[model samples]
Target: MTLRIRRRRFGQIAIATAATTALSGFAQRAFAQRGGPILYGVTLDSTGENLIIQALNLATGNILPINIQRRIEPGERISAFTAISGRFAIATGPRMALPGRRLGRRSRIISSTTEEIPEPQGLDNDAAFESLLNTNDNNLLSIISLNQGTPPFRFANVDRRSGRVNFLSDVDLLPNRRYSNLCQSPRGTTYGTSLGPDTGPVLVQFDFANRSIITGKARILPIAPLSYNKNLLVNDVADLALSPSNQLFALADPTYEGTNSLFIVNTQTGEMTFLRKFAVQKITFTR
Candidate 1:
């Protein structure tokens, strides 16, 4: 199955342009956070026939390229770009083949493409989606899984150093679940919620027993979307995410019923509040 989502870069950076005083609060926190490198990566859009990613000091257009580079995947399109501390990442969606045309559904390969610094965050067929890059003691990649080709969504993890993945649980985390989202906090911890299958955003967490092993555990944390119904396009929620504040924020698809809007949820206290909604176009975010 081909993965679906958006990719963007540096996100509409607000502070870099703000005056020295006005920028102190947000900028100090964002740029001065307690972490390692301040680098970020994203699959850049060259506008037409040209796209590349490079590091900048918010000054010169120097564009210091990261070692790994690849034109947007042939059939795979990049939709979102983000960076953690300094590691850059890109979200990718599949370019499905038409009926009886191209590879078609019989391709038998997962197309969701996620790229991360050090290497690709996701694989050509890992079928990865609804992902986020975590930057702290160890860079962690969080994402929802479509590996089963089923309705409910599943959770997966990647080793920041090796770019390898492990199931959240022995029995696919959030098994038979759907319409889910994931987010990491300022504490070097990751949080997630089960979207569809008629359940709240259960909190699935990652734990490292030793430097070499990773284990996922969950606590059915509660979250309300302020407006969730049976009609939400389950597949799309699988591409959902939240702000650093635990507020719910997801890509909105109008084809969906009940005025599907993106909002913020207070994960610390299972509360849902509407953020905004999209009309017809798709919402893409980049670090």
Candidate 2:
């Protein structure tokens, strides 16, 4: 909380200043009006040394910059983020903290303290949280853990106010499968991306209420090869966000050469249509 963006050299500062001035208009509009579905995510500064939160208007393709910028600490990186109600939560490794800003206002770090989620029994201490979702209940956040030598990933709910974590029962159906980019619909349906046995990347649904995988709905995604580099194929979905209207957007994993792409994913047919170039590290939908 309240982390500052590290200042850069004189030359870099000049460039950042110019960029900031250019973005001032978008910021004003973002704070001034209530609009359609907005996608929020973290992107690196022009210097690639600081992280800036941005809001994208799906209907108008306008990008707005949040006032706060934070520098990544040594060996630390943003792993998960979600925006729901009037608040947003960000996770850097095992720590989760709420930013100070409410919608339509300049952001501040609300609390000076960041909460660390305790690892469940039998889970490797090194396993960190990889995904976060806003559930129907505003008081609870759904979380998924990264598998580090573990067979099945861990699922749990974190109490937003008390910092309490309640682990769900094991999902035995998805043993040895690696899933990431977890997102949920307004109806409490959870979905994530995972690799298929032969077809490559696929979308899998989970029934959190029943603690079971919806195997019948899993479908292999028809991801296309990179336009610039035909040899490079997208191996994973870096992030996923679902709108209130049920539109699924996906961020394709950056290539080894560092090309980032975004797409509109058809959940029923597993077809992905190219949208545009994307630079965000994580994404979530907010109204």
Candidate 3:
């Protein structure tokens, strides 16, 4: 049993599901104070080898399509992506075998400069799959590698202003486990899920300013497994998003199960509250 979902480097798609609880009033007030409506962007799988990227207004549920007229080829498919600074988005495409090479693959990152126009700006990069991506309030891009081998993970920061990419160090203080989901809270703390031996579905936080995980400060938080409904079990997290008020939202899926679910967890308590059972593959929040 294999549950296959979109695997785009720095890009993903979200399929809507049924959930009744509306956005919280406190969250709404937070957005209002931020001076704009909260908008969400999603990439929907469409017919043929293409994806439809669109933006949704969280306040009114109004959706605006960004790439309805664009044609995406197989190698050009988006693997993972995130919106940055409320004005632009950065996305990565599928890995491709370098032509005429013995055995090598390369991935690329592009930016959606404007929602109205689908033209993307390509950023320079070598051959490595970008597994995770997130942006801070200052629009600084954070990217990490998903490749599994010697020095399995590497972190880099992309300066949006100068288009300069800088490799980072000193994050070895974090658990040496694979991270499936990563997001930044409004206050600038980085949170991600670590799935590894002895770790279980653990939520890990890092203080970028301090360049270390808040190890001694917070207790280990683990994501609880959902009871399978008709073979639906959420054992793996596909993606994560953080609200302006620092609420954590996760799109959890099983390796090979019937259905997926959305969960909200409080980092302080390490308790996860099941929010809704939906088929949404990925989700993110912005204001």
Which candidate's lDDT is highest? 2
- lDDT: which is higher, 2 or 3? 2
Candidate 3 lDDT over residue span 1-287, tens digit each? 11011021222234331122122232344345334344343454546443444443343433434443333455443444565543334344444446774322234444443233232223333323243455554444444544322124455555555545555553442446554456777666667666554445566665445422544232223344323232323344666778777677766654455555556666664455665444434466654
lDDT of each: 0.38, 0.54, 0.46
What's model 2's lDDT at 93? Answer: 51
What does the lDDT come to for candidate 1?
0.38
| Model 2, runs deviating above 4 Å | 1-35, 46-49, 94-124, 146-151, 196-199, 209-234, 254-257
* Rank ordering of all candidates by lDDT, starting from the highest: 2, 3, 1
- Model 3: how far residue 110 lies from native, Å: 2.7
Q: What tens-digit string does per-residue lDDT give for candidate 2 at 87-134?
A: 456555533323772212111112101332332333344455567776
Question: Alpha carbon lDDT of residue 94, candidate 3?
Answer: 44
TM-score of each: 0.49, 0.66, 0.60
Candidate 1 — which residues are off by over 4 angstroms?
Answer: 1-71, 77-82, 101-126, 144-154, 160-162, 168-171, 187-190, 197-217, 225-262, 266-287
Residue by residue across 105-193, what tens digits does model 1's lDDT show?
A: 21111111233234444444535444554434444444444542344444455555565555455324445665334444444444444
Which ten contiguous residues of candidate 1 have the minimum total lDDT?
104-113
